[model samples]
Target: MLTVKPILPRFGAEISGVDISKPLSEEDRRAIIDAMNKWGVCVFRNTGLDDESHIRFSRNFGRLELAPLRRDGKGRLAHRELFDASNLDMEGEINRDPSAVMYRKGDRLWHTDSSFMEKRTSYSLLLAHQTPKEAGETWFADTRSAYEDLPQEMKDKIENLKGENSLWWSRKLAGADISDETIENGPKAVHPIVHTHAGSGRKALFIAAHTKDIVGMEPEEGRRLIRELIKHCVQPQYVFKVKYEPGDLVIWDNLCTMHRGGEFDAENEARDMRRTTVREGTEPNSKDDDDPFTELFTGMPKSLSRLTAPEAEA
Candidate 1:
């Protein structure tokens, strides 16, 4: 039998007694799936998972989304950025110019992975390889509760609203030159501001960093409304911070949670963790599809792009 313990009253659970480093029995695996459906976040502690082990374990949940070279560099390594944060500089400043994108400085905005893509991320698995003396926890907001807390009037307003989301907006914020092909293939795609859980039949707010504007609204008005909606979805009462410790693995439902990286001395300490994302099929809301970019493999891996230069030099 599985020993499942709640980490928080509203969300999060720690699952014990399963050695993720090895193959799991069918019963144990089923228990995990059930726990994931019950609690949006499930944590497995100190399972001795290296890169290979982490990949293997994540595969148990669903199909693994390949880390594109554009996103993870030319080699496109097995795991994405999960490691000991202590490997950073004494001042915690992220050095290594070649690794700049992975170390950009920002207020760590809240978002669900690949919501901009037609195929959204179903879940995310992150393992803490290093811990700090203090600070640097990741925070999550229960989007389900965010929607529930909305004023009835506001809920009615969003019930029929759709917003355009795209990767270009986030890439632009990150200071990268987005290609025309990227723009054409990745223009804003529309999704309902509120979505029903395909599994549990519960409703959740479905907007985040990748969201650009509400369909058919003037830019300024849309901006104001989206800002308000996002704020509503990230209320303090629905949020919690996860302080990292070495050997800690956390997985969350990307559909109903919004997460932001916490403050830490990146200049003085190292914080590393590996992450894997599993995708749920995309289901867009009805709209004109104003985003010119809509190709699935356009700016993806050069190997998949028909009209790209040689993959970036390693």
Candidate 2:
């Protein structure tokens, strides 16, 4: 039997006694899903999953979304369904590309994955293949708890408001160098600032770094509000930090929480992780056809990007 233990008072749980490398029975899946709905984040210790096994396990939740191709058009790391979240390049060496470095820096800012896409993201499954020696933890904020703590008046004020999200806008905030074409073709999506969890029917504050501005408000005012809300959501009591280890898999509900990668010595340490996201629903948004990163990969070479083994030297 799988054991679920609370890791934090309000938001995270540690799940043990299940090997994710093999197929999960229906009962196990239900228990896992129930735990996710209750805790918002679940950590599976010692999963020991390879790229293929990772994809297989993630599919148990829902249909997997293909990762966007690298800007270089070389190909994606491991399987097409895996989003490469490593500091290393295709050759398993520290990446020195200025653009890639800047892009990775944006992960330090709290945000939900694929929020700029119309289809959005349901859950994110991140498997740690390698970890730095220190200070490379990931932090998660319980937006569901943040929402519950809000004043009734504040809740009422944002009840019907929507925020526009753009990938280029977040990159700009991180001071990343991006091309005109990338911005022009980037996704712009509008989603409710307050999201209702599909399975649990609970509400959560959904604003994050990708949130550019509120739909009908003045730009500066919307930005100010977003900044304030993010500040409130990340208060110490509402946050949980995950210090990763190789063979660890952390699954988080993108709809109810916000997360950011912790700072580490990218120049000296190797931090490699792979992620697979499940879409919230079956149908793709019409605007998904215009996703800038998707367009960049069209006609790109098909090559399997390599992953650094956990035992590999930094």
Candidate 3:
């Protein structure tokens, strides 16, 4: 039997009584999923899962989407199916590369994983392998609760509106030096500002930092509205902060929440985390006139040209 206890009144729960590294019984799996649907986020302590087991556990919810091959400063894939969410380089040491560090800075902004992709992500499972002694945390906002608390008129105003999201735009905001071509070619998606959950039939504010503007609204006004909505969504009551332990694993529903990485002393401390994302049921609505850059860089970086190149080549 599994045990679940609410961590916050709004939308987070802590679950125990099962080892996630081992295969789950059908009953246990369903129970976990149900709890997640209700709470939007579930935290499992002391899971201590290896990469293979981590991937195995994540697959219970839906098909495992292959993560884009992201290289470290040395141009090496960190893990096969996991998105490296650490401050470390490919060699297991703290990363000093300027580009990698700037890229990581974007995590501090609130956003859902894979929102800019043609295939939106459903669930995100992040496992903490190493945690800093102080100030390294993840903050999650309950967009479902935020949506429910909205005034009827405000809800009506956004009920049918779509918001555009772009990875390049977000990275640029964080001061990352992204090339113009990369911005134009990168994945850009449009999603409903107010989305109804398929399973629970509840609505949630789907806007986040990845959201650049509303589809039909004036650019300045749309950005201002987005900023206001984000401010509203992250109010104290709707937020939950998790200070990770080495073996902590948090599974969150990307459909009903947004999260951001908390500030930490990256120069002195290390934080190692890996994430696996499950794809959403419906295809995403992309704004790009042609296939996004994600397709071109699916398995590896496009600059690599061919995978058969000698290992010595950069």
Candidate 4:
């Protein structure tokens, strides 16, 4: 029997007694996926899987995409689908880079994973390889609820409107490079500001990454309206923070939730974690998307050697 229980009423679950390191029985795998779809995030405490083991487990859900190249570090799992955010140096201080426009800013912004990708990540699995004594928490917002709360007029206005989301703009904010190759290969695509979950038929807000503007609206007008939507979507009431413990593995559905990393002291503490990204497919509402691999990585450097984005430009 499955041993899954709700960790919170809104968005999280905890599953126990199943060894994820080994091949899962078909029924067990289905149960876990069901739990994820229902809860949006699943946590496994005292998880025994190592980096490779964790990657294998993520594959059971869908095709696993390698963690983005720019997010890896040495002596860490930054190989193909794994990212190591461990012991990074920012201004001669440890962990200080958490707010670095490039390295750890995603957690500060409430966003669905890889929404900037042609095929946005469907789920994110993060395993805490090491946790500092006090900080390093992750927060999540229930977009499902965030959407339900919008005024009908706002909803109707965005119902047919599609957003032109771009990593190029985000990378630029961080001062990351934008090459001619990147521009040619990486062009902005449109997705509805609201998405209907394919599996559950639930709706969610899809806006993220300081999106440049809406597809058909003037930049100034789009900026104002998008800002209003973001403000409404990320209100404190719809969010929750999860503190990490060593050996805790977290899996989140990027389709229905936006997540951010919390503030922690990098000056004196250490934090290391591994993440695996899995994508089901691009949502039907997204427009003009193709070659997810290229769309997901075009503006970023070809290799992990240059992981910082434009935001971090000194």
Q: Which ten residues in a row have the lowest lDDT in candidate 1?
A: 305-314
- Give per-residue CA lDDT, model 2, range 109-219, as digits (tens): 889887877877888999999899998888999999999999999999999999999766676677765554555465578999997887788999888998988999998
Model 1: residues >4 Å from true position, as ranges? 70-103, 171-186, 281-314
Comparing 2 and 4 by lDDT, which wins?
2
Q: Identify the leading candidate in terms of lDDT.
A: 2
Clashes of each: 23, 0, 0, 13
Local accuracy of candidate 3 as per-residue lDDT tens digits, 1-314? 88999987968999999988999888999889898889999999989797888988988877556544333323334444576677876567877566666666778889887677756778889988989999889999999999999999999899999999986677677786666566666667899989898757899988888898899999899999999899999999999888899889999998999999999998778888888777777332212233232353553223323322111000
* lDDT of candidates 1 onward, in order: 0.65, 0.79, 0.77, 0.67
User: Model 2 lDDT vs. the true structure?
Assistant: 0.79
Sort the candidates on lDDT, descending order: 2, 3, 4, 1
Best by TM-score: 2
Give all candidate RMSDs, comma-separated.
Answer: 7.2, 5.4, 5.8, 5.7
Runs of candidate 4 with Cα error greater than 4 angstroms are 68-75, 87-102, 171-186, 282-298, 301-314
Alpha carbon deviation, residue 137, candidate 1 (Å): 1.4
Tell me the lDDT of model 4 at 14. 80
In angstroms, how far off is 167's CA in candidate 4?
2.2
Q: Which pairs clash in model 3? A: none
* Worst 10 contiguous positions by lDDT, candidate 2: 305-314
Q: Candidate 3: which stretches are off by over 4 Å? A: 70-79, 179-185, 282-314
Question: Which ten-residue region of model 3 has the weakest summed lDDT?
Answer: 305-314
In candidate 4 the C-alpha lDDT for residue 5 amounts to 81
Q: Please give me the total number of clashing residue pairs in predicted model 3.
A: 0
